[model samples]
Target: MTPFLTGLGASLGLIVAIGAQNAFVLRQGIKREGVLPVVLVCLASDAILIFAGVAGIGALIQSAPALLVVIRWVGAAFLVTYAAFAAKRALRPGILEAATAPRGMTAWTAVLTAAGITWLNPHVYLDTLVLLGSLANAQGSPGKWLFGIGAATGSALWFPLIGFGARGLRGFFARPASWRILDGCVAVLMLGLAVVLAAEA
Candidate 1:
């Protein structure tokens, strides 16, 4: 139980960061664009990554320097691209205030986008799965399950709070300026994360 708590704390430490997926999740929730599906995808993706981590794949993944490099470059590319898109949206006349308008995407699209964003981000695996897995391995035995559970729980805990919190702010942030602010923040965040990731990788 002590080890489990340690693992849980570690998981929360890794997750409680500013990142693209969280940003997107928050935006979707605020905009009410298939919030449930977005949150579910975020949770499911976290579960898969955490499971992989607990299974001791992190060490092997670490050993594969080439793969990590590829992921770093790919992630950077995606981040830059996403940042550009977010910046573009920020400039658009109605992107932000569109929340009161009809949703531009279907439910499936929302699900896929959320899942893909979570899955594609290199930091997600590096922080949650690999780091959490290695920590659990140190504890051994049933501790692995606990660590995975902890990480999964972190995601489960975070996504709902973010999603719901966004919804709660919808009424106040329903202005066009709000969308501009959100998207601008998204762009800055993605670019910053990408720079940090590439520097570390």
Candidate 2:
């Protein structure tokens, strides 16, 4: 129970931050587009990574610096491109009538984008594969598996909360200006993250 609680708390601490993946999910939630698929992808990805970490793959990943280097560059490029799209949306805020607004992204596009955001970020690898893995391993054997389950549970709880709970903000987001502001913030965040990733590379 202690290991489980510890793992839950640690996972929340790491994932609660306003990173690229969270921002994307938030936007989808507000737009009410592909929310289920996007949330599921995020939760599933986190579970896979957390368990993989616990399964000792984290050490293998740590030994392969070249893999991370490639991921860093590719992730940076993807972020920049995403940022540009967000900036474009910000500049061209369309009429956002709750019942009439066009869907900004298809389900397939949202799923792919969510996957890219989750899988590409080297920071995610460090946090999940390295940091979480190391923490889980410290618990030893069965406890480590419990710890991994707890961490994955954290993701399960969070993604749905943020994704579905965001629908409550639909009234506020009905305003085009509100969308503009949200998109602008997302753009800045993506660009800033891209710059950080590039710097790290």
RMSD vs true structure, all candidates: 1.9, 1.9
Q: Estimate each model's TM-score.
A: 0.90, 0.96
What TM-score would candidate 1 get against the native? 0.90
The digit string of per-residue lDDT tens for model 2 on 1-201 reads 988998899999999999999999988997888999999999999999999999889999999999998999999999999999888877753433432266667999999999999999999999999999999999998999999989999999999999999999999987778888888899899999999999988
Identify the runs in model 1 with alpha carbons over 4 angstroms from their true place. Answer: 94-100
Best by lDDT: 2
lDDT (Cα) of model 1: 0.80
TM-score of model 2 (CA atoms): 0.96
How many residue pairs clash in all the candidates, one count each?
Answer: 1, 0
lDDT of 2 at 62: 91
Model 1 lDDT tens row, 95-177? 54453477666789878778767776777878766788888777788877886787688788888999887878877776778
